[model samples]
Target chain A: MKELKILAVIAALVGITYYGIEPYAHSVMHPEVSAADFTFKDAKNVDTSLAGNVENGKVLVEANCIACHAIEKAGHPALMPNADAAASYGVVPPDLSHAGRIYDKNYLANFIFDPVSAMHLSHKYPVGGTKAFPMPSYNWMTPQEIMDVVSYLQSVAPKVTEDKEGHKATFEAACGRCHSMAYAKFDATTPKDSIKAYMGATPPDLSQYIKSRGEHYLHSFINDPQVLLKNTSMPRVGLNEKAQEEVIAYMEEIGDSKKAERESLGLWVMLYTFVFAILAYLWKRKIWSEVH
Target chain B: MAEFKQADSMYEWFDQRLGIDKFVKVMMTEYWIPKNINFLWAMGVLLTVMFTLLVVSGIFLLMYYKPDINMAFDSVNYTIMQEVAYGWLFRHIHAVGASVVFLIIYIHMFTGIYYGSYKRGREMIWISGMLLFMLFSAEGFSGYMLPWGQMSYWAAYVITEIFGGIPLIGGDLVVWIRGNFYVADATLTRFFMLHVLLIPLAILGAIVFHFYALRFPHVNNEAGEFFDFDEEAEKYLAGDKKNSKVVPFWPVFLSKDFFVLGFFLLFFFYLVFFHYGFAMDPINFDKADGLKTPSHIYPEWYFLWSYEVLRGWFFEIAGISGKSLGLMAFGFANIIFLLLPWLDRSPMVKPANQRPYFKYWFWLMIADLMVLTEFGKLPPTGPNAWVGFGASLVFLILFIALPFITKAEAKKVGGK
Candidate 1:
């Protein structure tokens, strides 16, 4: 019993002594630069340009991306067979022939920065699950090199449409990494299991996405999916406001031709629900009062 | 239907046949503990909670973690952080939980010292705890290797190099551990299994034995009476004054335990939500590059003190190599705690407060450990090296000096 008070007092002293000596000990012990301080957190930011020449872009793609991607469809085979690539990486590299016709340019640029973080494919296809992302990060590529590659992809890809009002080019560049449409090479001959293998969950065919989600919702969501659903697997695409609008325009044009008609039909359904609710409330009150 | 309390409730139906309620009562409700035990006893419950968090969160992480070196980085960064549903939260909880567990263990040791928990017949508990500490260090190291990042690769390289300091078999032993000429696919696979399976199971087994050992002795309290239950009965028969004073373990100790657990979890959640990256080195984000080494490499914060002590032996010694002396100093600094039960020659089983100079020495050790930790974090050059050397020397000296000093102090107590 006598020892208890002393133990308590010493324990408190231990706390006080450690805290009291800490500030002084750390400052003196590490008067010089510490290795912990030699980190990239304090690194200076360098500005990089993502604009480059298409002719140069073609050369860069052949130099860099062409080993895996066949730009002209027949000239280049993958360094390994498609089956070998599939067995190794889960997803065989797709042909670059239609890449520019399917993906958004702004989104495509960011994807090149960090494919894992940008695409957020980690959770969708886990390690032992049917698939996981196999894209090697080209994080070493300069901003200009990325733009040059994008230009080359755009240069080689066939026009989805020459229509001035449509964003066919942007759609082909950004969304085409995962989704393909009715006229795409993948649609008819592609096996259902093959889609599930790489995508984990077969991405709902996006040809009618605007029809289901509506135009406004698509605009907001194209920038970041996690805003609506906190646990969304999709990464923030990090598109500028104009790029987001352009992506939405493409979806509106291709995905939902009858969007106006569907929205007009929604008003009548809401009106009917309102009138029925009022009628039901009055009838309930009348029946109860009469009983009383 | 409204009755919530009964001696025999819903589970009693099964309990009557199987004697399960008796087991519950024996383990929890009727479990006797010393009344004078302070908030320090709360650490045992807290440590259990920490272990549970580690295992639960670790299981969720394992679902997506690839053991292969080729895909390990992507498995953690791309799929887990970017795409996995709430994978970031689970990962943060795990990473943060590891450091927090070590923090609790450090304090838990201090708590034991104040109450003289290692004294009397409780030596087994202290020994088993030391074994847990050793295994936990390995567990932390192996888990850190799983990400296959820049620091992960280098840390593996640096730690394995220490084994090569052994005279003849060291070279072969390191090669065997790596299962390769270097840290590679095989090393990752080995570490993944050790982190996720082998070490955790070992720790669980040790914890079981530790508490089982404690059941016979009861908890050492602030009074440090070291009283045997049978001795208490003998005293009671002789009509001597006795104090059995204990509350049921269910309401009193359990409530206090959960209160500490709740407080700790609040801090844990706050860090996971707001400042999860506080302890994590950003260098680890980079994928493993064998060609490039970071300008400075050190182990995790928990290992800083020993690493610094190891670094202090770089200066020339008379016969032994610097690495050998450093290795010896490192081993002694870490393993000395294990020997304290035998080394502390004091006859009395009283707590630190009851002793004249024990508290002063303990406070000095804490300050020394803090200084060593600082030296470990910094490069061993300039003033840091000198300080490191001084701290390492003192750390070794304390172990030798303790038993003799404690014996003299007891003699001064005049045959109490």
Candidate 2:
């Protein structure tokens, strides 16, 4: 009986050891990396065709930008194209394809050299007008590289357009389920207190008010609402500044567009519940095994 | 007639109730314990009891202990201060108990070597005992780090990095075990799991098998005599003539054991209560931060010999990169101990029976160990390192040359 007891104890120990150490062994043998391959050359490679002069702007990007940003044609796998514009690495990669049509060489040059002073938004690149991602400063970049990159960008980028119809449809598809039109009338019986209580803040009527706010302010406010208001309750709309401005313009043209307001909220609720259910199931299984 | 019948009935009833006769029969006939066992024989039982104490106290502590780096030190303090009832007593007993265990085991091995217990028919037992000693050391050192104290942190960092001395893949191997460039949360967590679970379980199993093998031939005494059955008396006796005193183990040997146990308890209580055992260092109360190197780093006293040897060897070879040679010498020193049972082979088992040459070398080894330990404790200054290095080289020479001298002495005696 004593021998049997010893054997049983040894068996249990061996079982536990195998279970505990095997996972660590597996982890050590194989390390995990993300699918996005961000190489150094892509961010720093200078486009000679964009700039009339042969400049070393690519070297500046390599030293300062490649740590976080990837500027290659492949950008990042998760980013998708919308309305012929492509978002890169979940951020709007300002398209140099149309730079020549918009800002002049000098405006672009000033913006690149000291972006904080030129943009007046407390950040260099205010994508979707939100501070979700901030561009790192390249103070070490020489004045010539800055001029060359800006000149290169100005030569290649296309003219900026104010298209409303395409943006309105996409906005409705993505966000209409969650929000109501800013000007949707409140019922007399529906207490004003309900709006403050339900929305958790004063919901603004954007139908007429949005026109007064320029495309830049509307774009900045939606992309990163906190950048404009320190305590804004509005969730970041997750759009790039250019996309945000287009959406705001689209909303103003349609005056009280109801499609986006109705659908976005329900989709968000369903998506959250689905994720919660899967997590709950896994947790329950883990607890059950421990108890047994 | 009636009185005689009543007495007979009483005898039968007593036999049925107590089974005293059967117990006596088993005690007299079935028990085969050796009669020639000595003080060194008690070490096995003492070690067993110490291991039991450690495991029981460890489990109790583990109940309240949290192994995470952020929580480990606080949890130990909590165990002592708030959570478990009388937890501090158990924690201190276990902590001090570890040192005491090693102390006893070292004496046991020294006794074994002095009496030549690792001779023919007992070499396997000695080897197994040596393996157990190594395992125990590993178990204790690994467990020390689980508390994530300042000493535990520094001790682990210095010790584990010793493996980095292995030429080509050394640095990578150390980093792999550490899970980062420096000892961090991953290293703490890994050490904790190994300490609490893996190594202890291995040591426990090995100890059981070790004793099982030990029981077969029984213990060799200071007189180096085995047991011989006296056919005329129907009992076992020592092989040696002068030492052949036969006594039942229960009454005679039990008395001596009780006397030893009493002294042991007195000393233990005095250390635990009156003398105030190992002081809990305030530095150990702090968490391990690898970026912050401690002013002085030293291992526990038991490891001082090897530590000293490495330090001394490095110092002597000052021109030849002390760090590399010091690490190599320390490792080589440990491997030498592992080779002892095979290295020292003589027909004689007892110290008195052995040649004078072997005796001198044995004492010299002990003295070298003490000097090395002292040298290990000193900082590796240029002069100290050189002195230590010279001392380490002398010790190594004595250690290797002793066996050859013993062999030569044995050959001379055989010729005579």
Best by lDDT: 1
lDDT values, one for every candidate: 0.68, 0.57
lDDT of 2 by residue, A64-131 (tens): 54454333332312123421121222222342333333333443454455444333344323545644
Model 1, runs deviating above 4 Å: A1-292, B1-13, B228-244
- For B1-416, candidate 2 gives per-residue lDDT tens digits of 22323336766767666666787644543333444454445566567767887899888888888878888875775444334565755676677678768767876787677777786678777878888888888877877787787788998889888889889999999999888887778888888778788889888878877766655555566467555534412533332322433434444344444444444444444444333223233345445666667666767656767877776754334566777887777877887766776677556666533656678877677666655665565566767677677778877887678578767866766732
Looking at model 1 chain B, which ten-residue stretch has the lowest summed lDDT?
Answer: B233-242
All candidates: TM-score: 0.60, 0.52
RMSD of model 1 against the true structure: 16.8
Interface RMSD of each: 22.1, 30.8
Under CAPRI classification, how is model 2 graded?
incorrect
Off by over 4 Å in 2: A1-292, B1-40, B226-233, B236-255, B276-279, B315-320, B352-354
Give DockQ per model, in order: 0.02, 0.01
